[model samples]
Target: MPGSFHGRLFPQNTIHLVHSSYSLHWLSQVPKGLVAESDLPLNKGNIYIAKTSPPSVHEAYLTQFQKDFTNFLSMRSQEIVDCGSLVLTFICKNDEEDGCDFWELLGITMNDMVIEGLIAEDKLAKFNLPLYAPSIKEIKQIIGKGGSFKLLHLETFKLKRDSNMAEKEEATLFDEKSRAAYIAGNMRAVQEPILVEHFGEEIMDELFERYGKKAIEYMKNYGKGIINNVVISLSKTN
Candidate 1:
C-alpha cells in the first residue's frame, strides 16, 4: 500500500497470507542514540556496528531492532486473519562477529576518502545504516513475547557471494578487477540512495570505484564470502 511496514498498512483481519523477502532486516530508521545530538559522534569512523563500535552502540542497534520488529509483528497481527501465515526471508547474523563484510568494506572505502580530503571526517562519522541482522534466537524470543504468532518453521542458509555470476559467461571472463566491480555494483544498487542523500551525487562514481578496489583486496585476504539468510514461517494466533 506504499507505506512503512512499521505501521499497519492493512485493515484488521483482512489479509490471508503475507510474504516478505530480503526486506525485514532494514529497520525503519537509524537508532536514535547513534544520531542523538552530541558533540561527539556515537559511532565514529564507521557505519553499522563494527569491531571497533562501543558496546553502547551495539546495544542501541539491538534495542532499535527489537522495537521495530515488535512493531512489525504487532501491526501484521492486526491485519492477518486468525491462523493466517507469514513467510519471510532476510539476511541474518550468525555467530560470526562481522557478518557484514561488504558494509565494512564500504566503510573502509569511505574512510580512505576521508584520509584523502575527498569528504569531511565528521560527515563520515555521522553516517550509519538503518539496518540490522538479528540472530535466530533473538527473533524467536521477540515472537514469543509478542504472543501474536506461532513459529511454524525457521532455517538459515548461505549463498556464495558470486552465486549471481554462476551461469553468466562473464564469470569465466572476469579478471580480479571485473569481479570486484561486479560485487561493488551490487552493493551500490542497494546503498546508492542513502549515500547520495547524505554525501550528494558528486562522489557516487568515485566512491564505487574505490569501493571496487577495496572489495578485491578484501577477497584476496578473506577469500570469497557467503551471505547468510534466514527464512521463517509464522501463523497468526487469536
Candidate 2:
C-alpha cells in the first residue's frame, strides 16, 4: 500500500505501518530548474535528463527526504514491537563512474528539450533532480541518527533478464513487444512532464509518438540486461 507524508496533515503516531517499493526516489518536491535563459526550444527531447544534470540536485531533495523519512521512521519506531522489520528496495548506482554517466544522459536529454523550447527555459535552468544512492555506511548513519532501529539483513544484487524467467524457461512470459512496451511505459512517466512543458498540447501527441519509438529502440539496443537492486531489512531495537 502507498503512504503519504505531508509533514503536517497526519498527526505523529496516529496510525502504524509503512511499506514502499521503488517509490522513495520520487521526492515530493519538484527538482531544481536546469534550463538556460538563451536556449529555449520547442518539441525537445527528454527533459528529465536535462533538468537533473548536476553535482546532484537530487542530493538537495534527499536532505528533505531524510528529514521526512526519519520523522516517519521515528513515529513508527515508537509503535513497532521490538524486532519488527522495515524492508525496502531502491534504485542505486554502485559505481560512481556508472552513476555519473547515467545522470549525464538524463541531463543532456532534458537540455535538448530546453533548446527546443518544449519546456520553460527558466524551469529547465533551475531544475535539480535528486541523486541519492545510499551506501551501507550511509544507511547505518541514518539508522543511528533515528536511534531506534537495527540492521538485520543488507544485500545488493543485479536484476537480470534471465531472473525474470520462470524455472522451466520454455518461453519468456512477456514477448519482445510486450517487454518494449513495459520499459517504454516506465520511461514515459519521466518523459511526459517534459514533453508537455516543451511542446504544449499541440505537439505533445507527436512528441509521444517520437518518444515511444526512440525509447523502444534504445531499450532494445542499449538497456543493460541487469539493474542494481538494494535490499535493506531493519528491525526496531529499542
Candidate 3:
C-alpha cells in the first residue's frame, strides 16, 4: 500500500517489501551552508540547486542522513515477520581516502570557471558538492549501527559510457536546429542554479552555451566513461 508523508507521497508500512535503487544518494535537502549567498552566480536563491559549502558540510550531511535512515529502519524492522531486506545502490568512488572522481572533475571545472570570472570566488570557496562514497569499512559501520541485520551480499562495479555516440549525437541524428535544442536540454541539468548564482541568468546562459560545446567536443575526442562502485544486499537479523 502507498501512503503520504507531510503531503509528500511514499509507500505505507503495509509494504512488506522495501527496495530502493539509485535513490538514497539524494540527500533529503541540499546542505544549508552552501545556499547563504543570494547574489552569487551559482546561488540562484535556491538551496536545492546551489553547490555545497565547505568539505566538512558533506560529512555533516551524511552523518544526519545515516541517523535519519537508521531511525527509519528501527521503526520498520519489526514489521516483517519472516524475512526483510534493504537494497541500496549508490554512486561511490573507488578511493576512500580522497573525494570521488566525479566531484573531483566537477571541482576542477568549477575552479577554472571561477578563475575565468565565470563564477564568483566566494561561491566557489563555499562550494562543496556532495560526495558521500563511504568506504567498505564505513558502510559496515552504518549497517551495524542502524539495524540488527545480517550481511547477505555486497559487490562493487564500474559505470561506463557508450563510445559509438558522437559528441552531439542528437544534432547529427536530427539537424542543426534540433541539435541546439538537445544541447539546451542537456546543459540545463549541468547548468541551472550553480551558473545562475555566479553569472546571474544572462551570463550563465552564455557560459552554458560555450561550455556545453566544449564539453561535447571533449567527450567526442576522449571516450565517455565513469568508474562507480556499489554495495549490494543485507538481511534483517532479528
Candidate 4:
C-alpha cells in the first residue's frame, strides 16, 4: 500500500526490527526558506549546500533534516516493539561543510549551461536538492533528545572510488574519461528524476555530458571525491 513514513504506517508494537539503508539523507521535502514566495531563493546557483552557500542556506537545510529525522525516529519508535532494534545506513558528512563536491560539480555544470544560454539563470537559481549528509554528532544529539532509542553503535566510513567497482570496470576506471563517465552515470541514476522534473527531459543528456566533463576535471585536479556514510544500530528503550 502507498504511505508516507512521516506518519504511522504500521500497527503499534508490531514491528520488531527496522532496516533502513541509503534513504534517510533525503528530506521529506526541500527546505522552506530556500523557496520563499516573494524574495530571491536563498541558495541561488547551487543545487545542494556548497562552499559558496550563505550561512542561512546551510542553516535552513540543517533545520529541515533535524525535523524530518526526529519525526522518523518518533514514528519508528511507535511501530517497534519494546526492546526491539533498528539498523540504519545512509550518507553522512564528517563536518558541516564537507562532502559536497559531487553536487557542487553538478551545480557548476548547470551554471555553465546558463552562461551559454542553454538554460535560464533564474531556473538554476531556484533549484535546490532536498538532501543532507548530517554529521555523527548531529545524529547523536537528535536520538538522545528523543529518548526513545538507545544508540548501540555508530560509525562512519569513506567510500573510495574503487571500493565496489567490478574487475573489468576497475581496469577501465584507470582511464580519466571512463572514470568520469562511471561516476556521472551513477549520479544521474539517483538525481535524474528530480532533475527532469525541474529542468525538463530535453536537457537530461546534455546535463550529464557537461557533468561528466566537470567530474573528469575534478579528478585530474583534486583526485576522487570522498563519499562519507554512517551506519548506526539502535535499540528501543523500555
TM-scores of all candidate predictions against the true structure: 0.94, 0.64, 0.60, 0.92
Top TM-score prediction, candidate number: 1
lDDT of 2: 0.53
> Model 3 misses residue 218 by how many Å?
8.1
The true-versus-predicted C-alpha distance at residue 118 of model 1, in Å, is 0.5
Q: What is the TM-score of candidate 3? A: 0.60
Q: Write the per-residue lDDT of candidate 4 for residues 153-214, one digit (tens) a residue.
A: 99888885434553564485367666667777888999999998988999889999778778
Candidate number that wins on lDDT, 1 or 3: 1
Model 3 weakest 10-residue run by lDDT: 41-50
The per-model lDDT (C-alpha) reads: 0.87, 0.53, 0.52, 0.86
- The digit string of per-residue lDDT tens for model 2 on 1-238 reads 2346423333444434445576555556553333335544221333333343343434544565666557756766765656666777776555333322333444455455667876566655544443345455666677788877777787888664334442446646656565545544555566567545544566445444444444445546775445566777787774
Output the lDDT of residue 29, model 1: 92
Candidate 1 per-residue lDDT over residues 1-238, each given as its tens digit: 7998889899999999999899999999988787547567888989988877898888998999999999999999999999999999999886565444677778988999999999889899889999998889999999999999999999999876667875687678878888778877888999999999999999899999989887777767876567789999999987
Arrange candidates, best TM-score first. 1, 4, 2, 3
RMSD to true structure for each model, in Å: 1.7, 5.6, 6.7, 2.1
Best by lDDT: 1
- The 10-residue segment with the lowest total lDDT in model 1: 94-103
Q: What is the lDDT of residue 23 in candidate 3?
A: 49
Worst 10 residues of 4 by lDDT: 161-170
lDDT of 4 at 184: 77
